[model samples]
Each structure stands twice: as structure tokens, then as C-alpha cells.
Target chain A: MNRLFTSLAVIILLTQTWIALRLPKGFYQDSFLLPVLLIALLAAAYLMSRLTQLADRGKFWQRPCQLAVPALFGLMILLVWEAIVRGYDVPLVLMPEPSRVLVTLSNNLPLLWADFQQTYLKAVLAGYLMGCGLGFVTAKLVVRSPFLQKGLLPLGNFMASIPIIGIAPIMVMWFGFDWQSKAAVVVVMTFFPMLINTVAGLRSVDPLHADLMHTYAAGKGQIFFKNQLPQAMPFIFNALKLNSTLALIGAIVAEFFGTPIVGMGFRISAQVGRMNMDMVWATIFVAALAGSLSYGALALLERRVTFWHPSVRREH
Target chain B: MKPQLKSLTQTQGFAVLTLVLGILVIWYIAALLMNGNQMINMLERTGQSWTYTQVLQGAYSIQRPPLPVPHQVAMELYQSVLNQAVTSRRSLVYHSMITLESTLLGFALGSLLGILIAVGIVHNRTLDASLMPWVIASQTVPILAIAPIVVVVLGSMNLTGVLPKAMISMYLSFFPVVIGMVKGLRSSDKLHSELMMTYNASRQQFFWKLRWFSAQPYLFASLKIAISAALVGAIVAELPTGAQGGLGARLLSGSYYGQTVQIWAALVMSALLGWALITLVGMAERLVLRRRGLTR
Candidate 1:
């Protein structure tokens, strides 16, 4: 039955794509055909969903199905998106098709790479390191004093709630119109989350384990290193993963305020003004790729560093 | 007197006050140092000899200082919020209202949509398998990067003002709520489910009487997150259009003209607004929980 649903989904998807391609240009625009096409798209989505459900029934196809379900879902959506825009003859400025975006992406590789370097390598990397490092240090300092923790925790939570990115202009004014300002914004944006997470993590050490370490005549440093730090690993990595995305966003949005000629945010805003939707989308594609890649890399590192942790161990 | 002083030191409010005072002192010194360089340069360019006290005095009031002193910022904030007419473009209150309108509207829509989607996902196996992954993946994309396109596209369709900005806010604020609500709705345990089954409870009855009540804490927690996300989204949306009626525009105009005080004032206002919004959500949570008899 699962195999049957899988074949049925594939058949529908292929048929839809082929029919969409074979149709005359703008055939569905302002016609009854548009509704029919939409219904077909819905049908395709429904079939794909059914196939996913069937695949979840057994372990026989678990690995392949796990990868296939999302891939097929994404492909179906993209195909329908392409068909709709082309069929409707939508203006390129309003929404460019995926094929056009890919073409523009390939053509603008040098420009995109420079933007990536300016935004990611120069600003995001420096700021992420400094911010996370400072946060960890602050958390460490706060962890030892109950009075300080009580005061700082609420303060840190409040700072986290503030729209920290609103400081981008002030940062630009202070640091000048370059990657440095962007880096400053990223630092501020990423700092409080890291501090809050690390504080929580460090305080999460098991009392029993701490007492055992005390029984063995363990010093403060020794207890922290052997027991508390290991317990804090998962929380630290959680903050790291969250900061990766936040750092990228901070750098990009800061660029929107003021920047040198190159950066992902600059490209996006600049292209939009020119009514160049494809270039805008291409930059977005790079950003999405960078974001997902960094997130994936951190997840891998977390699994490696916290292998003894239950969440990671449970998969085995 | 000694006992009173000792008791004051033990309180959390006292600690926070001490920390904030410490921060202010550091900020003052840092501001003096940063602004002093440019102040000395200007004085030197004019060939006027300056003393340390003179430079320190100048640093606190220097226009467009590299770092505006806290008092300077507070003064600007005070003037902008009170001195100007509330409807005037120069008024921070006007800009804040424009931004707040969208933030509140988008937050409402996003929460509704998110709750609906969570309900659908919980009841359907296929949606759980396919849509859940996409929902998570959607956040991994820098959705803010598309703010410009959304604004421009919607503008072309003659949808202007609050709706476009609100849509961006909705996109962002929905994610946390969906994730939270799905986890909340599924949080019912074996004993409860067995009891519901014994009662021959319908799906709606099980959901309303059991799952809904159980999900309250998670929903409120996520609501706090969602409101803040909505505020950020509204501000970012204002950026791309370079719109004239929001706090984002105030920041942009300040940057353009080198008005550091204005930028700082806007920043402070937005921070206050965020605190207020979160506090409101927290209050609502308390009220709801108390009504449900879950809290005393």
C-alpha cells in the first residue's frame, strides 16, 4: 500500500509538471484554467502527504523515506510555484520564477561571493566569537554569586526582550559605515541569549554529582571542569545554534541601515530598489544556504561534543 | 540603621539598582572617553586650549557625540515624547503608534493562524510527517531577507499602510506559536487519554476539556515570544520601504542626518515598547491561569 501511494504521487507530480510545460504561455491567466491548475496543485500536495504517511508505517524504507518526503514535498511546491508564475505571466519584479533565480545566481556568483565574505566572514564571524565568548564569561562570573545571579538574570532577560537590532543606526554612527558597525550590532544581538542560556546550563549541574565531587575533595575549578561543564554542554550548544542564525540576521539587517558597497543585506535592498527580483532572490538563496549550513554544522558538532547526552544517545 | 541597610542590600531590587548604577557609571566614563577625542579635535582645530574638566563637560552635551551620554538620551526621549504634539511627525509617540498598530494586528493574526495550523497537524498523520519538517525549515531561512520584496509586491497590489508590515510580522510571530501549540496539544498523558476514552469523549470534547486546558502554559509562553518577534518584524518591515511613519524610519532618518540623540531616543522607546508588550502578555497569562483555577 505504501509502495502504491509512492508510485501514485510520482505519477501525479510528473504528469502535472509535463502538462504545465506543454501548455501555451499564459494559458491560465484570467481564465478558468487557473482554478483547475490550483486544484491540481492541491491534489498533488495531498498525494505527497499520503505517501509520507504510508512511508512512516515501517522501518524498511525509513532512511530513504526520511530524506525523500521533504525533498519530494519541496520539489512539488517549487514545481507548482514555477508553473503558476509562468502561467499567470507575473511581472518579474513582483515574483521571479525559480529557474530565473537560479540563472541569475549562477551569473552573479562573484558578486554574491563578495557579499557573503563581507557579511559572513568579516562581520558575523568576529561578532559571533566575541559575543559568545563574553556571554560565557559573564555567565561564569554570575554563576558563583547567588546575589549577582538574582540581579543579572532578570536584567539579562529584559535585555534579551529589547529589540536589540534597533541599535544598528547607533552602531553605524559609532563604528562608521563598514562591516564593523554590523559586527557591533551582531555582538549586541547575540550576547544576551548566550548569557541567559549559559547561566541556566551552568546552574543545571546535578546536586548529587556535585556532592560526590565534594566528597572526593574536589575544588571549585575541578567540580566545574569535570561535572558542571559537561552538564552544560547541551545548553551551550543550544545557544550556539540559536546565535548562528541571530548573528547572520543581525549582520544583514545592519547592512540595510548603512554599509559599504558589498554585503548580503546591501545586495538585497539594492536589488529591490532596482526592481531586480531575481537578484534579490538569489541573495536570499545564498543567505538561506549559509544559514542552514551553519545550523547543520552546529548540530553535528553538538552531537559530537555531547555524545553521552540522552538526546543524542537516544538516536542510537 | 545598620539592620535596615543590611536588609536593603539583601533585596533583589537593591541588587538590580546597584547593577544599573554600576552600568551608568561605566557608561558615563566610556561616553566621556569616546566623545572627548572629537571634542579635543574640534577645540584643537579652533586653536582653543581646553582643560580636562572642560572636555568632560563638553562630552556630555556634544551634538552628534560618538556616544551620547545617558542623560542626554533621556532628555531627548523626554522632549520627543512630551514636548512635541502627539500627531506630529517629529513626535516619537506618533511613530511608535504606527509601529505598534501593525505589531498588535500581526501578532493577533499570527497567533490565530498558528493555533489553527497546530490543531490541523495534531489531528492529521500526513500533516505531521510532511508539514512539520517544512515548518521547522521555514525558520532556518532568513525570512527577514524577503521583507523588501514583500513590501514592494504588496504595494504594487495597492495594499499599503499597516497590512503589508503586519504580514511580515505574522510570518515571524507564527513559528513559535505553532511549535509551542503542537507540543502543548500533544502533551496529554496516558491516564488522561484513558479517562477521556472511558467517558466516550468525542475528539472535540477531549481537545476542549483536556488538551486545551493542558496547553495553556505553553500557549502563553509562546505568546510572549511571538509578540516580541512581531515587534521586530514590524520594525524591519518599516526599513525596506523607508516609510515615514514608524520608529524604523526615525532611526533611518537619524542615521542619515547624523542625529545620534534621535537614534538613541528611538532605540529607548522601542525597548520600552517591547517591555510593555511582554508585560501585557505576562499579565494575560496570569489572569488566564488564575481563572482556570490552576493558580491561587
Candidate 2:
């Protein structure tokens, strides 16, 4: 069955390429090229399935081949996109081809690098560290006080509910249009998650463990450092992972409202006004990469720090 | 560690005192940081030493040098909602309503689409293979990038107004639902499926009797996230089109005119709307779960 699928996909790909080349000059002018390309692409997919099946064996090669399927699918999408845009003479202003976006990315590497530095390195990292650090410390304080638990949690909830867009302008007003304002927005975006998660994590130590500490007559600080903090690592890491994504989003979106001439959000919105869709896509590509990589790194750190947690143990 | 019952009160009291002192010191430092110009102007306006009210007013005022006072925002919020006509184009209430309409519409459409796609993926291996990765990749394309394209395409086709914005909302909102619903629908145990098979139940019957019921919590969780995402999408859609109504447009105008209070009010209103919508969905989830004896 797998062999059959691979052959079918290869046949489809060949037919798509053939038909794409065979089209008449004026035939490329019609909007129908999109539909034609889609059909041919489907055929190519079917032929590729057959080829995959033919190559399949119970070995390492098969595993890589399995991984390659999605990449192949992505390639087909880009091909179809390019073919349709070129064939139909689609205006670049509307939707630039993927190749153009890549070209733009390569050409403007330095500018993009500066934007990345301003938004990601400066604002996102600074804000995330401050917010998460403050949240962790405050959660410890709240754990010590029933009054604070009652008062601060609700206040935190309220602050979290404040829309980032609403707060961004005020932050710009307060902190100025430099990266500081964007960092402030990231702090606001990140603080609540960290606070809530830390509180939950601190509360999660087993009752038996607390009783054990009580029997030993351990001081409050001793019990917290030895018992509670380790137990809270998993939950703290969860917050960290969440904040990683939130910080990026907050910094970028906050930059949309006000910023100096540099930042990913500024470039994206500005490029769109200029009808430079390719540059916009390239900026987005960078943002997505940054978000995913940050998330991945956090997840890796979580695995290391929470190695004894049940979830990590089970995964291993 | 569990606190000794006797020491609990002392610990609690000490913690509260610490919190209060911390806040006070922070506030004092913040006040001290403000320059002589701001302090003198503040003192001259109030005709007194810097009082809490004056400081708060300074914090939240719409003018430069200080943020809008919370009370000033409260007053503006009051005027925007109570004094102005709810349907008047000039009112924040009207703009909120317009944005809310798109949000709800998009949320519903997106949820339906998400559930349908999830159903297909759950039941059909072919579709699971072909479509799931695409759905994941679709999210990688930033909504900001797509919103303008969607607006332009739909505008050229003369399908402007709420639908284009709603479509964009759906684009963002549906992915979560699809993911959550897929996980929920697949959550049914092997035994449950085997039991159904042993009873010779039809696919439709099995779905209605089992899969749909199993997916409720996941559906509700996704709905909470999706509704907020939908509202965000609606706002973003407005940004690209330069629409003169809706919360997005309100924010844009507020920024343009430097009406910080108006911007703050619109933002507060939208956040309230998002919270309200999520709470409503959560309440409905509770009701449904309670009816099913799933909630305590």
C-alpha cells in the first residue's frame, strides 16, 4: 500500500511540472491558473506517495522519509503559490511570491537584524526577566500572607485583563517611544502568568512533605527552599514556557503603536503601507522563528530543571 | 510547609505589613522621581501638598508628563457609556457593540469550522495525514500578514463590512478549537470504542453517543481562548482596513488625536467585553457540565 502511494505521488508531480510548462503564453493571463496548478499539485502529491511507498523499508531511511513528507507538502504549497502568481500575472502588491519574500529577507538581513535586536533582545528579554522575577518573589510573599493572597490575586487578574493594546500607548506615554515602553508592555503581558503559576506551584507541595518538615522543626525559609521550591519547579517552568511566547508577542504588537524607527512590528506595519508584502512576510518569518525557538529553548530548560517531575519522568 | 496554627496569625500580620510598606516605598520613590515642573504644576492645580488623590490624578490624567488618573478614566468611561447614545457613531459604546458583533459572529463561525475539521480528522486517516500539518502551518503565517490580504481580497469582491473582519477572526480563532477538539475527540478510551463496536453501533450513533459528549470540556476551554482570539482578530482586521468604527478603529483614532483617555476607555471596554464573553462561555460550560453531573 505504501509503495502504491509513493508511485502515485511521483506521477502527480511529473504531470504538474509538464502541464505548467505546456501552457500557452496568453494562457498564463487567466486567473484559472490557480485552479489548474492546484489540480496538478494534487496529482504530484499522489505520485509522490507511490514513490515513498516504493522506497519504504523498516530502517532509519524510512523514518527520515516519513519526516520528509511534511517538508514535501510545504514545497508543493510554495510551488503552487509561485506557479499561480506567475501564471495569472498576479500583482505583487496583493500577494508577493514566496521567492520574493526569501529574497527580501536575504537582501535586508542587517536591517532585520537591528529590528530583531531592538524588539527581541532588548525589550522582550528584559521585560520577561523582570516580570517573571517579580512575580516569583511576590508569589512567595503572597504565600506568607492570607491577606495578600486575597488582595493581590484579584488585582493581578484585573491587570492581566487589561488589553495589551490599551496599555501599550500609555506605556509609550509614560516610558517614551524607545524600547523601554515595549519592554514595559512585555512585563505587563508576562507578570500575571508567572504570578498565578508560581502561586499554584508553591501551594502544590504534598501535605505529607509539609508534615515531615513540621516534625523536623525546620524554619519557614528552610522548608520553602528545600521542600516547596523544588516541588514548584515544574509549574514555574510551565509559566516560563508560556512567558517566552507572550513576551515576544507583547513586544512586537506593542511596537505597532509607537516606537523609534527600529523594531519588527514597526517594520512590518511600515512595509505593509508601502505595499512591500515580501518584506512584511520576511519580518513575520523572523518573528515566528524567534517565537518557536524561544519556546523550544524554554521547553528544553523545563526538561532539565524538572527532571524529577512525573511528566518528565514519564516522557523519558 | 504547613504553618503551625499558633504562628499563622503572626506570620500573616507580618506579611501584610511588609506588603503595605513595600507598596508605600515604591509609590514614594515614583513620586520623588517626577521632576519639579510636574510636581509644581500638580501642586498648583490641587492648591495643596501632594495628596493621594492628586497623585492618582497625576498618574491617570490624559495629558503628557503623567498618565491619566484612574478616576479620570472612570469618569470618561461613565460618560462614554451612560451619557452617550449606545448606537450613536460618536459613542464608544457603539464602537464596542460593532466590534462585539463581529467577535461573536466570528467565534461562532470559527467554532463550527473547527469542530467540523476536527471531526473529519478524527474519523478519516487520509484527511488526518493531508490536512493536519497544513492547519498547523497556517498558524505560522502571522494573522497580521493575512488580515490585510483578506481585507483587500474581500474588498475587491465588494464583500466589505463585518464579514471580512469576521473571516479574519475565524482564521485566528479556529486553529485552537481544531486542536482542542481533536485532542478531546481522541480522548475516548480504547475500551469505550471497543464497547461501542461490540454493541454494533453505527459511526453516527457512536459520534453522537460518545465523541460529542467527550469533547465538551475541551470545547469549552478552546472557546474561552477562541473568543478572546476572535476579538483580537476583529481589532486587527480593523487596523489594516482603516475602518472608522469598532474598537480597533477607536484605538487608531485615539492614538491619532492623542486622546489617551478615549483610547484607555475603549481598551478597558474591550477587555471587559473579552472577560464578559469568556465568563459567559465558562458559565455555560458549568451549566452543561452540571447538567451532566460532571461538576461538583
lDDT of 1 by residue, B123-207 (tens): 8766766676676566655655677677877888899889999998898889878867886786665578778999999999989
lDDT of 1 at B246: 93
Q: How displaced is residue A48 in candidate 1, in Å? A: 3.0
**Using DockQ as the measure, which candidate wins?**
1
TM-scores, all models, native as reference = 0.87, 0.77
Give residue A114's error in model 2 in angstroms. Answer: 2.4
Please compute DockQ, using alpha carbons, for every candidate against the native two-chain complex. Answer: 0.43, 0.25
Q: Clashing residue pairs in candidate 1, if any?
A: none
In the range A157-248, model 1's lDDT, one tens digit per residue, is: 67776675568777877798899998899898889878977887797787799899989999888998999899988778867876887788
Indicate the fraction of true inter-chain contacts that candidate 1 also forms. 0.42
| Model 1 RMSD in angstroms | 3.8
Docking class of 2: acceptable
Superposed on all Cα atoms, the candidates' RMSDs to the truth, in angstroms, are 3.8, 6.3
Can you write out model 2's per-residue Cα lDDT over B85-184, one digit (the tens) per residue?
8888778888988888889899999999999999998776445555766675565455665678888878878998899999988987897789778767
Q: Return the lDDT, model 1, position B132.
A: 65
Per-model lDDT: 0.82, 0.76
In terms of lDDT, the poorest run of 10 residues in model 2 chain A is: A307-316
